[model samples]
Target: MGWAVARFDFSWGDAEYHQETLENLKAAIKSTKKLCAVMLDTVGPELQVVNKSEKAITLKADDKVILTPNQGQEATSEVLPINFAGLSKAVKQGDTIFIGQYLFTGSETTSVWLEVDEVKSEDVVCVIKNSATLAGSLFTLHASQIHIDLPTLSNEDKQAIMTWGVQNKIDFISLSYTRHAEDVREAREFLSKLGDLSQTQIFAKIENVEGLTHFDEILQEADGIILSRGNLGIDLPPEKVFLFQKSAVYKCNMAGKPAVVTRVVDSMTDNLRPTRAEATDVANAVLDGCDAILLGAETLRGLYPIETISTIGKICAEAEKVSNQDQYFKKTVKYVGEPMSHLESIASSAVRAAIKVKATVIICFTSSGRAARLIAKYRPTMPVLSVVIPRLKTNQLKWSFTGAFEARQSLIVRGLFPLLADPRHPAESTNATNESVLKVALDHGKASGVIKSHDRVVVCQKVGDASVVKIIELED
Candidate 1:
């Protein structure tokens, strides 16, 4: 039995090109079953001002500015109405404020930088430090003791999830600005109310100081953690952000949860090609053992989204190719789920066997996708084929391939690939045969070209009588 390929058209208005790419991708998968899933990044609840200007207003250094609690009001050098009313009280004298279009130009000119001079009941006075265009953009309040009560899920965020995410079968939801485990719990609770808990996984985006402070607790509930470098840089110094990224990825790897590094190629948003620094950034994230790198505005609203994807994909693939296996495997990862100990152990042993035999692939038969996650935690060198049976889980896993939830679930983990297959197919499985899994793997392996005639393959499953894992030799 063959699964129908789900296709999505990007917002770039290249429908014909999109269709052709989809057809080509499907054809390749039909013949070789090897496919990389690409996920589109959706806008989440990242706070920004609602600009009412037709164009951005440029502000020079020393220009006086006003932070107000109104919206749809034009922003000028003298006065700017901000959407967030709390901003006036959340900042103090000598505080730094960053306002902008969320572009990581690394140039202070893209965003207005200000030093707060005084605070009023509903307004704050500031003098511009840099020349920048003040438009509809979010600002970062740089103060040690300031508190901003940003909601975990904004109304817009909820609407987007209910419509775009659920209706389109989005695989992973990355919760932006997650402050604590409670925030994750709230999102899950909200999704559960919408009856979408099982359909999509939640990835907590660790961006701010609070998120960093409660990182450990947050991981317990988060399917994955996305190190949001852009916003993180605002909260912490760039050097510290990089350090935290490495540290967070290490923790995620150790816990067996997927860790993603986002904004690795922010410069790609404007340039057709990546800068030397951007290229090195992507490679370094991979070298640091991140499961995936996220392309933010580079793909969301960039000039060359497809090219950016191709470029980053090549960088990651090459980096992994030459990555040090010793460094990759030289970690003592503790399993995240306590109840999954037995299954985790089984997964561990299977990874070891695959390495010992230098197996070309590891095929896992799963119902709830747990086995796939367990095996992925081990970070095997060879490709992984997680054969899922449930229809919803299958669709969800397909979304994961798209990097929809790069931090938590991804097709970029080493060589992991997930697919939907029937355990009851006559050519691959049957009620009369207890070798359903073996036959399924053989058929899928051959079709995907990952397994060929006489190729060594490792199969992992928990069928009635089959070993959790075993070495198998393919035959023509």
Candidate 2:
């Protein structure tokens, strides 16, 4: 079955309560055999800062700030307490301090302005930088989304996000309301600078008209795209949004990039059940070749989060069974170009071989998940088992294909010995060859002691510079 991510949106206050909520949601989802990832929505550019001083004043790192207007506007700047001596140097006569994007200014009253020299202390009012704290909280929750608003992002904050992803080992970073190719490039460059681009994948959210126009360029840098229909619909006409959604999905498939269709798929965000239209919308997206679909309020803070996920899974599975996989393959295949690397060629060949032999399963041995990602780009029909030594690597494979199954390296080796011992197996065996690693995977779970002997399997592995594909038979 395909993997789906559960997205959560939070403000600053929700930070302390996130862990408990996450644990509850995780347990509920596990009961239904569904897996979910966390998406943390950071502060956006809705805040503005204002300075009330007649003379230019410098704000330092140390300041005790009280935000006066905190109802509608949220804080985006980090809060730092200031000592009396440092505060004296940072503020001048008739100076006001502003902290957030919402234009909140700290100004001395006219009466206070007259007595500036007599004032012993002053208050530096500013909005709090709650995005990072929220992210840090959700990181403890092990979320799937792990999203942050980029327009309001500072260089230092950007590095912090990348560092967090590397340290905690997050799978996907969703950029909110992305508009241009430069946005994607900047994010990629920042992650690369921090040595994190290889491990943490980026999912760019196309939420505006500009993002749609520059879709190709954006996709070139992004590992995946998220069709955030809610924001897109808000930005454009409804009819235009519909057309754009289809075009975007098609383009993403053509570019060999995974796209997730997200929004209020089910109007049941407040209710306990979804409407008929919601169900059809999800099914249609599945038929339209969406690699995955996202659940927003429906699975995040909705009343029936678990039920919503289960319903989505059921609908996607049914749609996939009847949907034309060949059509998707044919449409996407023409878009594939010359192989960029040896691993790319191997992955392409593996897909071609799967189709050639009508293989039931495609097994992959990977350390970095690159090998599996390349194969998934081809969108094969059979299930893909990504066998890795580290369990965390298996978690990272969630972004690639739907049917990723993880197996211990030792179990993989044990399952192959019997197949290598037997010569009468139906499929060709490459056990004697130096590329025996390929042979072991194809024969997994075929031995009598560890696994049932009557199982048949196919395995693919990267040997030397090429990915070797082999088929094997089991003996009892």
- Candidate 1 — which residues are off by over 4 angstroms? 1-45, 135-145, 333-340, 391-414, 423-437, 465-467
- Point to the candidate with the largest TM-score: 1
Q: What overall lDDT, based on C-alpha atoms, would model 1 receive against the true structure?
A: 0.67
Q: Using alpha carbons, what is the TM-score of model 1?
A: 0.83
User: TM-scores for all candidates?
Assistant: 0.83, 0.62
All candidates' lDDT scores? Answer: 0.67, 0.51
The 10-residue segment with the lowest total lDDT in model 1:
1-10
Please estimate how well model 2 matches the true structure, expressed as its whole-model Cα lDDT: 0.51
Taking the tens digit of each residue's C-alpha lDDT, what string does model 1 give over 98-158? 7766534456777767789898888888898888765444443333324567687777667
lDDT of 1 at 76: 70
Error of 1 at 332 (Å): 3.0
Global Cα RMSD, each model: 6.0, 13.2
